[model samples]
Target: MIRGIRGAVTVTENHAEDMIQETKRLIETMAEKNQIAPEDIASVFISITNDLNATFPAKALRLIDGWKYVPVMCMPEIDVPGGLEKCIRVMMTVNTSLGQKDVNHIYLNDAIQLRPDLMKEE
Candidate 1:
């Protein structure tokens, strides 16, 4: 069966390095938390807030081992009033035995505010 994992992270700046680093961190966290393997991933969709255009978030995945074969697409997130700034979000579809309810969603930094209900108290 296929399951989806969602994650988001905030970038401190619009620079390419910052975007790359933050996205790398987010993806790495998701992969680690869910035990996602490259062969299990179907595709990844990445969206960035309008304020962040310095680089595509998907580029960071290419730097990771075994992610080169995963299909990735990137787009601009819809700009809404009062939306969080400098945020990048990802939705990865993967073939997993885990049920949807078992999937772990990750949100880091200021982006955590975007999904309080999914976050567990730590």
Candidate 2:
């Protein structure tokens, strides 16, 4: 079966280093929390808020040891009124045996507020 894992993170500024670091952190956490192997990932779609345009988050994925071959795409998020700023969101599609309800969706930093209901007590 195939499933999509959602995740988001916030950066302090629009610096390329910060964007790359935060994106890597978010992706690693999502994979770790869900026990997802790099080879299991079918594709990853990342979107950053209009306020953040320093670099492409997909660059971080290529830096990962086993993720060089994984497909990834990055784009700008829709600019909505009152929307979260400096936020990077990701939707990773993976081949897994876990059911939809069992998948873990990660929200880090200020992005946690974007999905309070889905946040698990840590």
User: Using lDDT as the measure, which candidate wins?
Assistant: 2
Q: Backbone collision count in every prediction?
A: 0, 0
> Judged by lDDT against the true structure, how good is candidate 1?
0.91
lDDT of 2 by residue, 1-122 (tens): 99999999999999999999999999999999889999999999999999988899899998889898999999889999999999999999999998888888999999999988777666
lDDT of 1 by residue, 14-121 (tens): 899999999999998898888999999999999999999898888999999988999999999999999999999999998888888778899999999998888865
Worst 10 residues of 2 by lDDT: 113-122
Residue 112 in candidate 1 has what lDDT? 92
lDDT at residue 57 of model 1 (Cα atoms): 81
TM-score of each: 0.96, 0.97
Which 10 consecutive positions of candidate 1 have the poorest summed lDDT? Answer: 113-122
